[model samples]
Target: MTLLAPGSAQVVAGNRRVGMMALRIAGAVVLLVAVAALVGLLWRPFAFWAAFNPTLLGVLRWTLIGLAVGWAFLFMDAWRLGQPLSLQQNQRLAVVGINGVLCLSVAGALIFGAHVVGVQRDFTIAMSSDGAASAAEDGRYNVLLVGGDAGKGRWGLRTDSMTVASIDEETGRTVLISLPRNMTNFPFAEGSVMDKAWPQGYNCGYPDCELNSVNTWVGENRELFKGVEDPGMNATISAVEGITGLKINYWAMVNLEGFKGLVDAVGGVRLNVRQPIPVGLPNEKTFHYIDPGTRTLNGHDTLWFARAREGSDDYSRMARQKCVMNAMLHQVSPKTMLTNFTEIASASSDMVSTNVPSSEFGRFIDLALKARGQKVSTVSLVPPAVDTSDPDIDKIQEMIQKGIDQAEGTAKAAPKKKKPAGQSGMTGGSLGSLSEGYVANQADDLGAAC
Candidate 1:
C-alpha cells in the first residue's frame, strides 16, 4: 500500500476536524431547543406550586415535563431535516422544529407568570393598602382598565376600551363598567381646549387643573401617554372617579400588543359566539367572524373579538370582550398552567406593563385565594347614568361627586363581618355618607374636587 505524504495527511485531518465541529455545534443547538421547550411546558406547574410554596422539587418536576414534550418535537424535527430535500429545505425544517419548541416553552412560562403577577398584584393592592382596601370596603373599587390605540401620525393616544371594575369586599362581588371612548366630558384639567368644566379657573388648587382637562394636560406632560389629549389616563381616572361616586385605588392600562400576547400565551382560549360577526374591517383589515360554538382562539382571533366594531357596535363588542376574558382565565388556571408555562411566559413578555412591583406578588396571591370562592358581578356606566350627548363638563362633575359620596359612605359604615382583619386603613378621617347616590338635582350640579 502506498503511504500518503505527511502534509496531505495533516490537511485531511484538519478538514475532518472542521466538519466534526460544525456537526457538534448543530447538534448542541437542537439539544438546547429541546431543553428550553421542556422548561416552558412545566412553568405553570412550577409557578403555581411556587406561590403555595416554591421548592426544588416543584421546579424539577416542571422541568422534567417540559423536557419530555421538547424531546418528542426535537426528534420529529430531526426526521424532517433528514428527508430527501434541498439544503435550504432541510434548514427550514430544522428551524420550524426549533421554533415550535421555543414557542411552546414561552407560552407556558408567560401564562404562569401572568396569573402569578396579575392576581398577586391586584389582590395585594386590594388587601394591604388602606387606600385600596377602603375602596373595596366602600362597596366599590373602580379599576380603570384602559386600552390604547395609537395610529401613525397621531398626536395622542386613542382610548380603545375604558373599563372600570368595582369590587365589593363585603359581598365579594365585582362590577365592570365600560365607558365609550367618544363619550363627552367636561374639561377636568385646566388650560385645556375645553374650559367650561373648570369655570372656577382651577381656584380649588386641584394641581391647578380641572377634572375634565386633567386627561389631556397629563398626557401632554407625562412621558407615558406620549401623544394623547383628553381621556388621557389622569383625565380618565378622574372621570371614572366622578361617575362611580367612589375612590379608585388602582389602575391597569393594557395596549393592543400586550392584549394579543396574553391571549395567545395559553395555547388558545375558547370563546362562545352567539351571532356571526362579519369579516373584512375597513382599510383592508381581515377580521374573524366567530361562529357560535366552543371555538378556540390564538392571539389573532382574540384581537378580532376585541376590535369587532361592526354588527352591534360597542355593545356587541363588549359582550365578546367579556367572553374573551373569561376564556383566557379558564385556559390559565393552575392545572392547565403546568403544561403551558413556556408559551404563556413568552407571550406575557409582549402583553403587559404595570406599576405594581414584583415584591407585592404574595399579597396579590392572598387576595386571589380569598376571592376564589366568592361571587363576581358586572356593571356598565352606559346610557342612563351618563350619555354621549351630555356636555363634558357637567357629566364629569357628576361622576366625581358620585365617587366622593361612595368613598365617604363606605369609610363611615360600621366594619362588617367580612372585613379582613387589620385591613381598614383607607383615607384618613370620615369618608362621609352616600346620602344621595348620583344626584342630578340642581343644587349639586356644580362639580367640586374631593
Candidate 2:
C-alpha cells in the first residue's frame, strides 16, 4: 500500500498525522513533475536546455539521492506497520526479503539514473568551456570542422581537412562546404590579419603556403596574435571564412587518430562500401582492404575507410570522409546515445576540442537532432570545380553561396541527381572517379549521393 500510495500504510495504522503530511508532500511533487513534463513535451527546446544546464543537473543529482533515502525509509515504515513480529517465522523471513528487494531496486534505479546525469554534466563541461554564447549569423550557424594531425616536427597540428557545416537556424537545413587543403593563392577576409600579412592572397610563391599551412604559419608566428586563446585555430578560421565567405559561429578541431575511438564507442557505423578500401598505408606489407557491401565497420577499419589514399587521390578521400560523416550523423540515434552514454561521452570529450560554449550546448544538440530529419547538402572546392593549385577565389565563394542558397530554398540546384545506379568509374570506396568528381562531394541530397 505504501509502495503505491507512499503513505497509505501509515494512514491506516498508528501514524495518521505523519501519513497526512507525507501524502500531501507526495501529491505536490507529482503535480510539479507533471507540469514540468508537460511543458517539456510542448516546448522541446526547454527540455533540451534543462537537460544540459549544469545547475539543474546538480539539483537533480542531489534530489535523486534524497528520494532514494526517503523512498527506502517509507518502504521500511510500511513493513513495520504490517507488524512482522506478529507473523510466523517463515512469513516474517519472506516479508523481510520482499521489503529489502523493493527498497534496493527502487533506490538503485534512481541512483543509477542520477549517476548517468552526472556523467552528462561532466562531459558538457569538458567539451564546452570556451568563450561566450554566439547567436545565429544571418539566420544560420556556420561551424568550421578541422581534421588535423600532430606530428613530431610540426608546431601543433596541421589543418589538413577543413569543412564548414553551415546550418539554418530556423529550419536546421545544413550545407557542408568543404575546402581542399591544397587550394592555393586564396585571399583572407577583408582587413583580417592574414589578409594584412598577404594582401593579394596567401601566395608566398607558386607552390608556397597551401591552405593547411596557415595553421603551421600561425603556430610559428604566435606573437602576431598575442592575446588570442588559440592562434592556429584563429588563423585557420580566418582563412576558411575568407575562402567560403561564410561567417563562422564556432569551430571544432578533431584529431584523426582519435576518431576511431568515437566510432568504436558507438558500436561502429554502417556504410555501403562501394569498393574494397585499404586499411593501411601503401608501403606497409600488412595492408588489407575492407571489402565491398553494406556493413558495420569497427573503429580501425572505419578510420582507414575515411582516410585511405592508397589507390585514391585527396579529392576521392574527401568524398569518402564526407560519407563517413553523414553515416555517423544518421546512424548514431538518441537510443544509441542513451545505451552507450559513458563510452560515447568519454571518447568524444577526448577526441574533440571545440569553442562552442556550455550555454549553447542545448541549442546545438537540438539543431543536430533537427538536422537528422532534413536532407543534407554539400559543396566541395576540388578539381573541375576550381583549380586547387591556383583556385579562383570568386568562383569558390559563389559555389559555397549557391549550395547554401539551394539548401535554404532561395535558389534551385543545377539538377536532381538520381541515386547513382552503379556509376561507371566508382573505385576507392567513393561513388565517382577523382577526375569526374565524387557525387557525395557536391550533392543536393547527400543521402542519395552516398
Best prediction by TM-score: 2
Residue-wise lDDT of candidate 1 within 1-450, one digit each (tens)?
Answer: 001121122233334453344445446656866775676456533344344332333454455455444434443444343452655876877766765665466445644555555543343333232222222534544556766653342212555676665545443234445555555433333433223344433234433343333455555556644454323554566555554545666666666655676666666776654456554565665644667555676777667755765644553455455445434533467655546655555555444434433433343434444444433233334444445445344554455444434433432322323333554321111111112111111111111101
lDDT of each: 0.46, 0.85
- Error (Å) of candidate 1 at residue 28 is 35
- After superposing candidate 1 on the true structure, give the runs of residues whose Cα lies further than 4 Å from its correct spot: 1-141, 150-156, 169-172, 186-217, 220-232, 279-288, 369-375, 391-450
Worst 10 residues of 2 by lDDT: 149-158
